[model samples]
Target: MIIAIDGPSGAGKSTISKMLADSLSMHCLDTGAMYRAVAYLRLHGDIPEHDEKSLVQLVRKTELNFHHTTSGTQIFWDGIDVTVELRAPIISQEASRISAWSAIRKVLVELQRKICGSGDFVVEGRDIGSVVFPHTAYKFYLDANVQIRASRRQQQLKEQGIIKDVKTIVAEIKKRDFHDSTRKDSPLTKAAGAILIDSTSLTKAEVVQKMIIEIEKIKEKLGKKGKTN
Candidate 1:
């Protein structure tokens, strides 16, 4: 079973998806971190962003792996654990920018599909529902107001010991939303049949519980059809 959760930044897709996966005993993959790892590689390796050929080659040659532990998911880039570094604010912007390139998305999208294909996964990202798992039975698009999203992002960064002005975060999210939605290769969008979840005023637990209920309903309907057949 594959559950795709698509959303803009700070909508709590990562946290909610993790909880949902735990509730169902399925693995959860964060596709954004994959791209962020790419950005991390380029930045650390001194590869130019506009150098598309180099970027694609870098991604193809480097090995990206995800290890989900009791605490959280650990991302390994080329056998080195770079999970903590990938969350830096600068990498987020770079990941967003590089993600616009068609070649880059093709490589990472293929990788994402291959990873999720291996197990029952709750996949979360900008395009998981719209592009990565378009045919999945369960899909959800999580969204919240920009201000609320910014506030949430601020709190998250604070937890990471990275402080930024709320207004700055708000502007960054707006810019990110535009980039993600307007990207050419696989723009961020709600997939057909995906349930729309507005989490502006909702807590993370509330969102995950609502999603679990919907998933169970879908599972029950599928079971009935299978038995009938």
Candidate 2:
């Protein structure tokens, strides 16, 4: 099965998706990282901002790979391990902007589909449920209040020894939410039939358990239907 977890930034989609993938014995595909990687390249490389053709050409020439180890998954861009650099706040903002480009979205969406096409993967990103895997049986839209979301992001940055006030983080997140939701290509949205889980007051474990219960219920229903057939 291809399970899609879609949500805005800092809503715990990454952590929860990893936990859910582990619990379900499925590989976790971090689609957001892919966009961030593109953003990283755009910043460090010579790709022109206004040139769509340059972006598409750069992406096509790039060899993006994910290496899974006991420590965690590491993303390599063109054989260079840029896992840490991709998480920078600047990259996040750029990812939000460049991801709106139709050409960029088309390339990355194709790569995402190919990676998860065989199934048994838990994918997380802004548009996974709505655009990448719309036909998947298991889909979730994880969200939280803007304040709670910003606080989570603040904590994450603090872990990296980069301190930022919650207010600044909140402003950045709100801007990202606007860019992501209002983008012309593959805007963030709740796909039809997706279960919305608000993480405003819930722990990560609680959210995972709730999703597990829902998945089990769906599987049981499908099993019984098979028996009847």
Candidate 3:
């Protein structure tokens, strides 16, 4: 089974998806990180963002990998472990831009589908449920208030020692949301048949547990149908 978790930045999709994947003994695919790695490559390599043809060629040439372990997921680009480097604020900004491009999104979506097709995966991204994996076995749309999401993002950046000022982080997050939501290709939105969860007041553990309950219900229904047949 594939569980597609779609949400805005700082809405806890990453944490919740990882936990859910662990509980189900499935792989967790952080689709956003893949795009961020591409952005990091573009910036460091001095590749222009508007060059769609070049970006598509670059993606075709690049090899991205996800390494799973007991602790967490690690991302590798071209055989180098760049798990931490891709999370930098600069790359985050660039990722939003790169992800908005139709050519880039098309290439990455094909890669993502190929990966998930081989194994059960818990995939998380802004458009995972809506665009990338619309026919997933279970789909969820996680959301939180804008202020709460901004505050959470600020705290996360501070913990990582990436940024100090909460105001600046919050502003950047708002800008990213605007860009992501208004993008022409596969803009971020909740998928039909997705279960919406307001995560503003819920802890990560709480949200995971709630999702587990929903998964169990689906499993039970499927099991009953199997027995009936």
Candidate 4:
């Protein structure tokens, strides 16, 4: 089974996707981190986000690998462990911008599909269900109020010892939301046939449980359909 989870940043997609994947004994693919790796490379090279030609060239040569470990999944960018650098605010902003490039998204989406080859994967990203795996029967769109998302983002940063004002984080979140939703290339929207989960008041565990319940129902329905066929 391939599960597609789509949502804006700080909406608990990562946390829920990880827990759900672990519970289902499936691999977890964080597609957003793939975009972040591209941005991190660009920021390292001083390449402008608007430089589509350079961006295309950079992504063409990029290689992303995900490793399951005792600590969790670790992402490698071109053989470098960059899991720690992916969450920086600059990278997040840059990821949101460069991800809008059609060529860049194409490159990453191909890689994403390759990564999920013949495996049960819980893939989470802005466009996974709609673009990356539209045929997947189990798709979910997770969302929360912008303020709640910003607060969660702030807390996540604080946990990592990178504190920023809640207001500042909130503004950035709104800006990124606009960019992600309005982008011409694979804009973020609810995928067709996806179940929408409003996660504002739900704890991470509660959200994961809800998703599991939905999956169970789907599996049972499929089982019955198979028996009839």
Candidate 5:
């Protein structure tokens, strides 16, 4: 079974998804990291911002991999570990832009499908529940208020020693949110039948536990139907 968790930035999707995957003993696929990796590579290369054709070509030639370890999820691009490099703010901003391209999304969607085909995975991304895995066994959409989201992001940046004013971070987040929601290809929206969870005041453990309850309900329903048949 596959669990799809979709949400915007700083909504606690990553932490929740990782915990949920570990509890279930399943693989966790961080789709956002894949886009970030691409963005990181593009920033270091000759790829232009508006060159969709070149971007598509670059994606095809690149090999992206995700590995789950005792430490955490590690991302690789063409066999090079980029776990730390992809976390830069520059790459984060560029990732939000690159992911809006339809051609790039198509390639990544295919890659995502192939990865989840053979194993149980907790996959999280903007479109994971809505587009990438519409038929997934469990789908969740996590969200929080814009201000709260911005605060969380600000705290994260501060911890990384990339200090910035709250106003600036909030502005940047709002800009990215607008682009993500209004993008033509695979705009971020909750999938039909997805359970919505607002993390405005919820702790990380609380969110994970709530999702676990939902997953249990799904398992019960499936099991009952199977026994009836």
Candidate 6:
């Protein structure tokens, strides 16, 4: 059973997906972090992001592995721990920039599916449901108003001691939305049959509870069909 949690930044996809995965006893795959790791690599390594061949070669050589730590899943790139570094503002922008490239998405999406193929997974990303795991019946799209999302994001960064101007963050979020929604290869969209949740006023626990209820309903329906068949 593969569950997809698709949403933009600050929509609580990452937090909720991990919680949902734990509740369902499934692995959590953070596809957004995967992209962030790539961006972090290139930014520090001085790799040419504009060159498709160089990008592809770098991706092919970069060994990205996930480790289940006490704090949750941590990403390691080429034997170095990069989970904390991925949240840097520069890397976040770079992730959004490289994610639009066809070469980068192709490499990461393939590897993402491979990681989750053997286990029940709660995979979260912009295109997890619409592109990465389109065949899965368990799909969710989480969204909130732009201002609320910006506020949430700013607070999160503040808690991390990274001070970013709220207005600048909001502008960046809007720009990222435009790019992700307009990208040619796999644009972000609500997948057919996806359960949409407007999380404007919901807490993370509330959202996870709602998601659990939805998943149970789907599971019950699938069970009845299996018995009838």
Candidate 2: residue 21 lDDT (0-100): 88
lDDT of 2: 0.86
Relative to the true structure, candidate 3 reaches a TM of 0.92
Ranking by lDDT: 1, 2, 4, 5, 6, 3
| Cα RMSDs, all models | 2.2, 2.4, 2.6, 2.5, 2.3, 2.3
Tens-digit lDDT track of model 2 for 97-204 = 888899989998988888776557889998888888887778899999999999999999999999999999999889889988998888899998799999999999
* Candidate 3 lDDT score relative to the true structure: 0.83
Q: CA lDDT of 131 in candidate 6? A: 88
- In candidate 5, stretches whose alpha carbon ends up further than 4 angstroms from where it belongs are 224-229
Per-residue lDDT over 1-229 for candidate 6, one digit per residue giving the tens place of the 0 to 100 score: 7899898888888888888888877788888888888888787777876776786787788787877532357989888888988888888988888888888898988888888877678889999888888888899999999888899899889988988888998998899899888988788899988999989998888999999899888878888552110
Candidate 1 is scored at a TM of 0.94
State the weakest 10-residue window (summed lDDT) of model 5.
220-229
**Candidate 5 local lDDT, 1-229, one digit each (tens):** 7898998888988888888888878888888888997787788668987888887888788776778753357988889899888888989989998899888899889988998887778899999978988876699999999889989888888888888888887898789889999999999998998999999999988988999998888878888542110
Error of 4 at 14 (Å): 0.5
lDDT of 1 by residue, 1-229 (tens): 8899999999988888888888888898888888888899889877975998898897788777888653457899878899988889899989999999898888888888887778788889988878888888898999999999999899989999988999999999999999899988889898898999999989888999999888878879888542110
Cα TM-score of candidate 2: 0.94
After superposition, the stretches of candidate 4 with alpha carbons farther than 4 Å from their true spots are 69-72, 224-229
TM-score of each: 0.94, 0.94, 0.92, 0.92, 0.93, 0.93
Steric clash pairs (candidate 6): none
lDDT of each: 0.86, 0.86, 0.83, 0.85, 0.85, 0.84
What lDDT score is found at residue 151 in candidate 1? 92
lDDT value, residue 100 of candidate 4: 89
Number of backbone-clashing residue pairs for each candidate, in the order shown = 0, 0, 0, 0, 0, 0
